[model samples]
Target: MSAHSVPAPLPCPAAIRLHCAGPLEAVVVAALQRACFPEDPWDDASVATLTAPPTGFAVIALDGQEQPVGFAMARVTAEDAEILAIGVLPQARRGGIGRCLVEAVAAGSHGRGATALFLEVAEDNQEAWTLYKVCGFFSVGRRPGYYRRRDGRVAALVLRRNLDGA
Candidate 1:
C-alpha cells in the first residue's frame, strides 16, 4: 500500500484491540504520533511516561501484522476523563482506525467510572470534528489560539462526549 493510502481490510476479521500500553510499545506509539501530527510529535520518552499508569491510559489498535495503526491516550481525574491525544497513521486513515481507538478509550474511561469525556481539536480539522460528532461529541466551547498551525495561524474547538449511555 502507498504511504498515504488506506490498505484493504485484513483477511482476518478486523478487530480493534485495546491494551494498557507500556514501555515496549513506545516506538510504535511514537510513530503513530508522528504520522498523525506533522506539526508536533511525541517522543519515545513522552510515550513511556504517559503510559506508565495511574495518571493515564494509552491504548493502541493494531493491524494483522501487529503494527500499531492508531492510538488514543487519556487522563482520568475524579470527575472527568480528558482525551489527551488520538491519531491514526496516514496509511491507515479512513479505515475506521480512529473510531476504533476512540471507542477503546471511551470504554476504558467508562470502566474507570468517568461520566464525561472531553477533547480539543484544531478548528480547521473538519474530518476529526466529523468523527467526534459521529461518536456523540458535542461542541461545548472553544479555546482561543489553542493550536498553532503550519501557516502561523492559531485555532481551537472544544468537544465533549457523555459516557453515561455508553
Candidate 2:
C-alpha cells in the first residue's frame, strides 16, 4: 500500500469484540491509551478515576486474539453524556475498531439514560471527524486552541449525537 493509503478494512470486522471496562481493567486501558496517544497518555490511576462507576464508564475493544486494541471513556450527567477519550492503536486503524468502540460507548451512555452523547475532536483530525460524522454526530460548538500539538495548538470541534433512538 502507498504511504498515504489506508489498508483495506478487515474482512471479518465482527471479530472485534467489545467489553465494558472498570477499575480492574484500568491498567490495560492505560496501556492502550499510551500506545494510541503517545504525546498525551493517561496513567492507570487516572483511567480508573475517569472511568469510575455510576456516572462514568469505559469500553475496551479486543481483537479476535482477545488483545486489547482500543478503548473509549465516557461520563453521563443527567441527560447528557460526553466521551472523554477514545483511541485505537495505529497498527489496528482503518479496521473498524474505532467505530466499534464509539458505538459501544454510545450504547452504554444510552443505557445510562443519556439523551445525547458528545465528544470533541481536533479540527485537523479529518479521519476522526469523518468517523464521528458518519456515526451521526454533528458539530455543536468549537473551542479554540483546545488541543495541544507539537506544532502548536488546534481548535476542537465539539460534536453531539442524539441517543434518543439508541
Clashing pairs in 2: none
Give per-model CA RMSD. 6.2, 7.3
Off by over 4 Å in 1: 1-16
TM-score of each model, paired residue for residue: 0.85, 0.90
The clash number for model 2 is 0
Q: Write the per-residue lDDT of candidate 2 for residues 40-116, one digit (tens) a residue.
A: 98999999999998988888877889888888899999999999999999989998888877887877888899999
Which portions of model 2 show Cα errors greater than 4 Å?
1-12
Distance from true location, Cα of 33 in model 2, Å: 0.6
How do the residues 31-127 of candidate 1 rate in per-residue lDDT, one tens digit apiece?
8888888788889888887766676777777777767778788888875998888998887789787876777777778778889999999888999
